[model samples]
Target: MKLIFYGEKLSNIRKLNGLSRKELAEQLDITEQAIWQYENDSMLPRIDVLNKLGQLFNVDTKYFFTQEYLIHKVSEEKIAYRAEDRESRKKTKLEITFVNFLDYYINFFEQNLLIPQMPIMDIREKTLKMLQETNEDRNECIKKIAEFVRTELGLENNKDLMYTLEKSGIYIVEKKLGTQIDAYSTVTQDGRLYIVLGTVKKSAVRRNFDLAHELGHLLLHDDVDMDILSSADLKTIETEAHLFASAFLLPEMQFVKDFQSLTRKSNPDYYIELKRKYLVSIAAMEMRAYALGLLTYQENRYFWGQLNKKQYKSFEPLDDEIPPVRPGKVRALLKFVLDKEVMEIEEICKEVHIRPDFLSYLFNLETDFFKPYLTTQKDYFGHTEVIPIGDFRDKTSTR
Candidate 1:
């Protein structure tokens, strides 16, 4: 049965569901050979099986018939910081699906709207030169790199980072990933970088640190094409990203001055006070203190011991009190387009060729969330893109 559909599309949907052909065959009560045939485009699923596939994957049945396949690249290296035990494959599979969804969402936005103009920023030559000269001393290089980025972004100190990034046309999205992986950074086909953050509720400080960490990857590892990175290479890059995040969040000079003022340097309570000012974790503050040479080797060891003894390693004070930050650019863009009657909810769903529920999951929004803004009839055939009326010129700003 030769159907005018992409077999690769079926394969992609199955992979997105994190299912092997045999596993999916079992679920569908079909033979593994049959599943392979469908994915290979040698056979078409019965209408009943197609409906079941749609229901199983939460995609419309038309999705299978659509000729469009995932056109962009998926970077796998940034997500491999995992235990090499039994859960390794499971975690990697989940990460793959998550990246797939992200790619679709990014394509939807970039293909549809043009509000945020993301310009590529690269300083690989200088960063590479400095690292080579410093004997790959990321500790020193990281501080300089962070300071350079802070200066370039005009960020003298801590401010709403997402607001700054969004104004600069960097798209940010928060996923409700409760997995061990906190976040990952990927570049689009057009050289636009998007940072995906994990929305592990009740810790805005951690989210802020994660964004800085990802920003570090985008800036410092500009040379890395994630498709070709090995696990060892990923570990090296991850370490560099961590160093950059630490230095970026708490400037060495500023952190040194602040740490000097702490009366009880070892106390988490003392660090908690700094957390309020620095918008970092009490624990991160303590580590930052050590990093800045504010704590001696003995003092750092003692502080770690204290952290263990006080049961502050996993659970810390103000974890609940500190509200987590969210990415606002996507949400803001949706509001602008929908409210301006530029596009309706059904229109977007149709244009994106995604199920409304799936779109909702991608954005961490409610199902039928856009249903309210849809005042007119469903106009799915014609693409109604909003034209840029006036361009904001001269100085560029993120917020």
Candidate 2:
């Protein structure tokens, strides 16, 4: 095969194996620049390097030479397919890569599980029908949904809920990938689903909507082609997801009752109260009001126009504060290992995919936290005594 075609196939295989160029180079004892060259079709790897690459990427050596492989390779790595476009100056390469990685991860998980066989459109219709028939209060609906998640996953708190979602193959990362993309969700190759949220979005309302939108995708459009969801067709999917989120967060019946109870006659104060109670944005509340026939089409239009003009504060409250950030997955895994007393600090660092320095960044301790957990023999009155770290948890010792 030609060098360019060979390089293209190599890149596809690398992505499929989830091996970054640096990781692959480290494994092969080669420079990352060399790996980049091979991926860019600028140079071909030596026959020995080719064989090693095949083994590392888990593809047969002959597979690279095939036309099918070349086509798949080109299609897979084409930057045009990326969620962000070239004109999007605000989006970084890291953001695009993270989103793509998330899609790949979700697809991987989905492929392993038996996703619902129903078509997404059908499911959406059915769910909407259920909502229409229920006539249940919004809080009751939210409580029910929360109960469903808790029962299914055995989650105890909001943090536990987040962890459960992650363990179930949902990917939520704490980084501002781009201004345009707050959060995104997608399915994996294996048919499992996932969601990724930008930690930079400090608003709980935004986070809640992101979660609900992702859940909408999972429940309403599992079988839809991912490409369609990324294209202009995405608008329809987004609209449906918005509806699902609004209804999921604030059922029509409860919202009407809540709105009626509020003494504030103006939309602004009413929205403030609604946002506080429901943990959703004022915009979402407005949409819910429109959907519930509380606000006429003209009223909805006027409200949005005022909002865009910045005439109102949009009901953001003083007490609506951002919470403290928690430790990420890698840190949490390390903590779990340390708490169980299963490994030394150095070993734990390696196992949890972090450097000692990075671990220090997560948890600022004087020394490695696992040092005190190690078992040691003590000399007491000439008798050798085994003093295990297990007793430290039993008694309150200053040391």
Candidate 3:
């Protein structure tokens, strides 16, 4: 049977590489219009051009001809970006494409093992029911929901937030999302929730806060239409998520008791101990305290002054000391399948229509995962040695 070219796949791959028609054309030695035509199915590329495209994309030539089964199961409009900027739409498109590839990978393992159930679904339903029953305001409802989530997770302390979420079937992916974007969360059509965190060398406290904030979006705003939300409306939503994050990370009763121990309410340095205990930033702790009426307006103002004067906003005391937790759900799952011989790396690549390196890049996995499957050659002593598949991007210039 003859295979037909799928132009939409070309567009997805191009966007995934952060490339534009003009830029890709320049690299392929073709006109911008030609690149556009090929992407829009207006014309087919020559065999040489197709070969070059495969090489540039680090995929088999047949990838372009194959049916694109792996698609963005999660809608971009439903995504809750922590920080949306001018380039957010483009960044979101790329990230969602990456998610589709990862979802495809996870689906491959579904035939062999069962994925865990998402606990957040139950938490959301219970919270909504409670809201309908009570006369609680929005913020009060958020606080109650946060407390309920903590109870549902069986978390006594603030630590292990990421681990607990992962165990509950939320996939936490840490990628180098640029400065503008800190984190985002979304639920796919198949009910898989994802929290894609930006690996910007943040403090553990900040990271935990980001995790909780995304979790808030996943649980609270799952049904909201984010695409039509105006700037002010989005801000309100962001504030709500922030409130949820703060309340969830720092439980009211626990934080209140902890605040009473702080002798100097105006001193930002004094809260470092609380920071150490809760694994929360001093700034966040102070805000949480103030929200709980532990600190007065003047005291909060003084705390802010000292915070800025000392420049603890960017680089806090424990920012370097307390390392952020690395995401392991996807990595662990992939490793399990590989180690169990469920599927060989080479076979997986062929089946997924992806290069090993590209697959690794999607999940931010180390290339060492593929080292064992490298090509082998016999030495002088008849001993077989591994020949590493060197950098895939060495042929193409960096984007």
In lDDT terms, which candidate is top? 3
**Per-residue lDDT value at 241 in model 1:** 81
1-399 in candidate 1: lDDT tens per residue? 654756787887677656789999999999999999988889889988988888887777778777865664555553433222113566455556667666666565545555443432434345566666776456777889887776666665464666666555566777755666677676654566678777666476777788888888877776665546666766777778878888888887878887889888876677876787777877788777776768888878878888899898777877777666666666655554565665566766675456667766667666776766654554332233321222222122221
lDDT of each: 0.68, 0.50, 0.78
Candidate 2 lDDT tens digits, 247-291: 666655667888777554235545775676676777777777776
Off by over 4 Å in 3: 1-3, 374-399
TM-score of each: 0.82, 0.53, 0.89
Task: Please write out the lDDT profile of model 3 over residues 120-182, one tens digit for every residue.
Answer: 667767876876788869889989989898899887766677778877778888777778778
RMSD of each: 5.4, 11.2, 6.4
Report the number of clashing residue pairs per model. 3, 15, 0
